[model samples]
Target: MPIVLYHFPLSPPCRTALCTAKALGLDVTIKIVNLLAKEHLNEDYVKMNPEHTIPSLDDNGLIIWHSHAIATYLVSKYGKDDSLYPVDPAKRVVVDQRLYFDATTLFPRLRATTFPLMFLGKTDVEPDKKAAIYEALGILEKYLEPTGWVAGDHVTVADIACAVTTATLQAMGVVLDAYPKIREWLERCNSTIPHFEEANKEALKDVAELIKSKVTHNVYAP
Candidate 1:
């Protein structure tokens, strides 16, 4: 049986997994779990993924959720070599750090601002939330300063993991102009990744439209 992925297209976490799988040339059966319809709350899906999160992977009988973990696993188990996720401890540490940064710092900050607007029709992001998003972006800028990629020279699962979230923030109209390094790195990721448009662009457009329809004011300034 083909590997199965349960995902919601507009979700960055879901897109991250999709992009990683595509990068590794892994064939997956895509099953859309519409969050708006609460399909993830179904009994069967809940049993497989108690967290009921998007982008859950069912590899044979094994199950996994969380984009970063899934991304790394795909590269580790399926990738012909350790290029996307190097086996060397010193090199892998940088990738691991960036992945952790995305999970703990970047995605949470972006979600804080966009989630209320997208799901609850909030018109504006709270001052603190907006500030937090920029703060996270600032940190990302520094991370990118030393190397072209988030995790060093080569494009790793770290870039795939963080780029999807960064792309979603851009779709939400976050001003990335202030973070020149991030903007450049995002451009590089978008261009270099195969099937980048199919993996991320279209869903990013959906997220942009959803945000535009619900929110009247711009949350990102400067």
Candidate 2:
């Protein structure tokens, strides 16, 4: 059986897997799960990934769930560029650490702040989530300036994982104005990487539209 990637465009973890797959130039099939339809909650999907998550990877019938696990598995199995998932022990550890932070720390806070607004279509209480979101962005900004990427001097699974969350935050009206370094880093990541733009496309339109609407309202406010 060929490798199949179960995913959703809006899901950060799913996008992480997608980005990694693309970066490796792997010709894996993508099965786009519909988050809006709650298709992922179906029993079949649940069986594949008991968690019923967006990014359950089927690798020649060996199923793997979780973005971090999928990423490592892909690199270990198929990555041509050692740069994608470096061989150095220390650099590998850094990638692992960043992935851990992305899965636990960065994603949770970002989702808490933005998911309620974007997925649920609720504009209320945005101000309540703003502080936490800003803090998260500030942390990313600080981290980007001192390092070449989240894991080291090269793009790794860490950058791919975090990029999903970063893209989502940008989509949900999280301002980047305060995080100049992060903005610059994002540019570098998208420009330098072949598949970063593909991974980012879904969120880009929504993000730009959201920002434009907000800015227009503010500009015309009495």
Candidate 3:
């Protein structure tokens, strides 16, 4: 049986899993979990993923959720080589660090600033949240100072993970002009990463539209 991936296209984490699967040439059946409709909160999905997050993978009987874990497992079990996620201790530590950075720092900052606007009909970002996002971006800029990719010279799963969030922010009108290295690295990843457009760009359009639709309606509108 082909792996079943429960996902919503506009989600950056979902795109991370999709991009990793494509890079590893794994056959996956995508089942869209519509967050707008709260399908992910349904009992069946909750049973499969207690956390009820999108991009959970069911490979035969085994199940794995969390985008980074899914990506690492796919690379470890199915990759022809460890190039995307090196097995070497020194190299793998760096990759792990980048993944944690995406999950804990970068993505959370983006979510904090945007989720209220996207989901709660907020019209503006708070000063602190905006500062948090820029602080995270600055750290990413420093990380990319030494190499073109987030983890290193080569495009790893870390690049896929971080770039999806970066692209999402870009779609949401966050400027990258100040972070020239990040801009350049994102350009490189877009050009070289397999299925980059399919996995990220089209879905990002949907995210932009969703956010616009939500925020356009004022809470006090008649």
* Reference-based lDDT, each prediction: 0.88, 0.76, 0.86
Ranking by lDDT: 1, 3, 2
Candidate 2 overall lDDT versus native:
0.76
Candidate 3: worst 10 consecutive residues by lDDT?
213-222
Candidate 3: Cα lDDT at 167: 88
Error of 2 at 215 (Å): 14
- Residue range with the least summed lDDT across 10 consecutive positions in model 2: 213-222
Model 2 Cα shift for residue 108 (angstroms)? 1.1
Each prediction's number of clashing residue pairs: 0, 0, 0
Model 1, 66-103: lDDT tens digits are 99999999999999899889999999999999999999
- Global CA lDDT of candidate 3, please? 0.86
**Model 3: residues with Cα > 4 Å off, grouped in runs:** 215-222
Q: lDDT, candidate 2, residue 36?
A: 69
TM-score, one value per model: 0.96, 0.87, 0.94
lDDT of 3 at 38: 91
Query: What is the full ranking by TM-score, best candidate first?
Result: 1, 3, 2
TM-score of 1: 0.96
TM-score of 2: 0.87
- Residue 151 miss distance in model 1 (angstroms): 0.8
